[model samples]
Target: MQHRPTIRFHGAAGTVTGSCFAIETAGGLILVDCGMFQGSKTEKELNYRPFPFDPESVVAVVLTHAHIDHAGLLPKLARFGYRGPIYATGGTMDLCSVMLPDSAHIQEYEVEQLNRRNRRRSRVQVEPIYDATDAALVLTQFRPVRLRQWQEIAQDVRVRFWNAGHLLGSASIEMEIGQGRDLLRLLFSGDIGSGFKLLQHDPEAPAGFDYVVCESTYGGTDRLDTTDIGRRRILAQEVSTASRHRDGALIIPSFAVERTQELLADLIFLMETGDIPSCPIIIDSPLAIRATDIFEKHRDDLENGDLLVRAIRSKNVRFTQTVEQSKAVDFVRGFHIVIAASGMCEAGRIRHRLKNWLWREEGTVLLVGFQAAGTLGRILQDGAATVRIQGDEISVRANIRSIDVYSGHADGAELSSWLAGRLPVRYAVFLVHGEEEAMEAMARRAAALVGDEHVYRPRLDSAFRLDADGPVDISQAGPPPRIDPQQAGHRDWNNDYQTLLLDLQAELRNAADDKARGVVIRKIRRALEE
Candidate 1:
């Protein structure tokens, strides 16, 4: 029987958010990510849906990074009865300790508001997808693994975590699947961070993989350099201009990970050089606070910018571990800067600040990361003259500005160069995350490097089974054993391991058989010929 792995994309296919993938083999099942679904009403609705497969049966979850899109749904999985080990980097583990719980709180709050709205509209009652207790349960499953070291996930699967350079504990996973005699190396690009980023080291490409699942968030477009330090100058000028207008606060909607810290560093530098006045800078999000602490903890990872950060740390200039102080910044109202999380302004303390300052003509909201569709951040980024926040539509009087200079994900060239460096690839599966256009563009560029014949941009619920022949499908096959037409069919999953195994076995058998494989060839021919 063919011993190749059966991979399924449960989420993060068409639009970025809710990143989850499953790999099934004879030995057991391994999931790459268990992230939450974000963006749009329809997409958000998917979070309430039950797991597509048996969460309890999943052997282990290897998380690439701590980004909510890649690691947020573990609590839901845990609450649903998954007790397997959840593997992630030390930094990711720590970040999740803060992020997962915060996510649960946000969910609870959002759901409560949604239900209130539903009641007014005379709609059915709704429940939160998962709670803080569920999130706390998943924390027990996490087993932190350091970077660049190989650790066995099961009898046949060995995994090594490498710093993806996206966030503090962000990593790209290199997993070797199948038993010793029938090994297949698969690499999962969680989210490739850029090269030459501040504070964090550059992304290091893993060598030699039989199959690759890569993220194409910015793959279609080239990285736009403002040319000759223009971005830095723009940022400095913007801050200076705003400071001159009034001593009001400059609230920046930034991801708590790399973006917040990078902005802090830049702001600090501008202050030190007298480019921008010495205004009190606050890293306001608790998640960003914890992430900054992790950045301080892992100072060794700072390849070139070690001394600058160290100097700042020594001077006690960084605003970390001061939540009360962060809140207090709002009252003082001088030429101060506050960088907060929930970058999209969908949720977080940033919302409170935006609610207060956005109507003011002089205040500015500096967007420092990608904003998902439907997020408050995106609306503001698109120059929405007015937007609703917590039932009140506020005018976009604040100076809305975005500087794409500090994104954690790699730009087009960096992604292309990373892919090109990893030569002799058998097949490449492009996972279009962050944005749809980004994924399509990356696929085109990857096709250029490795030939279009070997590239695939898979959509949600698509499956790719890899073998010596190439990728095959087990997805569209009739009635997967775990899935049932009837609602409340938990029995179909709870004790149906045998059925899953048998179906997988049959698929493998059919793939191995020359006659059956020949049918697939003819089917491909008919489609191509048509």
Candidate 2:
């Protein structure tokens, strides 16, 4: 008897980062994505753990995009000895060439800092997951493929790419396994873009599949559909209000790939058209600077590509590619707009900018994308009065604002519409890459289109068998999950410890006298004893 194909969920099952899936066939094994985890400490720690499966066993890797959460772990994969062909669109490959190396640099730099502290405290040292050499080596394995074309990746396995519209080269992968009578059709909706995106065309894909795996990033929420003009109007209002302060700075924490480029275009347009004051616009991220050049290189493929080209070349816009230049922004006087990277404020130059300006009443932090739970951006959005960054506690006196018009992921309604477009799913629809609530919410909406019995929300490390008829739940046969489902998207103990420290400081500060402070400390000591 022939062995039926099986798929295992390694990451992005219960949370919104580290998107990886393994498919096993008679030919061997292939992976859809090998992404890195972000967000909470628990989630990010999963990146340090070994991949659930052997890297050498993977025959090919079909990358959906270049986002760190979707493609960040490629260098680590290469470090672990997987050197097979990693397939992606030409645009995705271009973005990854720069992005992967940047990610490695961050790893090395952060680890270096961590080791310094560790050595001072007599703690064990930790090594980076991968280095610059590993990142550069992985690029040699990437093989670019065009959209809407079928390519045989492994024996009896053929794959095709569809425009996902989320980023420059983001794609929805379509696959066919086996041949003739025993063939199976599957589709992976790799981060569907909001249809109202300003940069790329609307997402497109073929319909009628045996099974489908979809993303639920914004599963339970819906937003007003903002057109390009409407989006620009909203941005203009924000810029106008923030720029009114002569000494204030407008700081935008953005993703380097798509969000940064889109913001630059709108900012430049608003400045040139006199809708907003012409303040100095500084691109303070080296990754974003390199990404913009890639965007310029692929301008002909984007909607209003000419506008982005013009915006990048605008005389008022400045690109700061070195650390010295980024630090020089601190000395610039008057009102200016600075855009930095790591949209979640988890890493990158955004942290430094936040540290410098978060205490100033005139400064403004404008968040333009989704802030996952436990991220600094979410903490700010949730109205935290103070925050700790790089071991320094800073008061959050600056105005914290957000605008959803620039989000790349589709909202709930748009995601459902995208799912509805792909009808006649014969087997099951697996929902991944979202929080628990989001997955549950999306499951309900998806059940209405397909039957309730046809939707499945697999936990991390869960595996399923795809037979000729439908899906079989074989998750128990697989290894246990690396992280508990309860802890996936939520804040970890580190966050709790930080909160405790802040609360203790506040309590001690508010004490009326030394006696009262001693009483507070005794209560804490008694609780610890208990």
Global lDDT of each candidate: 0.75, 0.93
Provide the TM-score for each candidate, comma-separated.
0.84, 0.99
Best by TM-score: 2
Error of 2 at 413 (Å): 1.2
What would the per-residue lDDT of candidate 2 be over residues 1-530, giving only the tens digit for each residue?
18799999888888898999999998889999999998888888889999999999999999999999999999999999998999999999999999999999999999999999999999999999899999999999999999999999999999999999999999999999999899999999999998888899999999999999999988998887578888999999998898888999999999999899999999998888899998889999999999999999999999989999999999989999888999999888999999999999989999999999999999999999989888999889999888999888888999999999999999899899999999989989999988988888999999999999999998889899999899998988877888788888788898888878877888898899999999999999999999
Give the per-residue lDDT of model 1 (tens digit) for 28-65: 88999988776654566667888888888998899988
Which 10 consecutive positions of candidate 1 have the poorest summed lDDT? 483-492
Model 1 Cα displacement at 3 (Å)? 3.6
Model 1 has an lDDT value of 0.75
* C-alpha positional error of residue 524 in candidate 2 after TM-score superposition, expressed in Å: 0.7
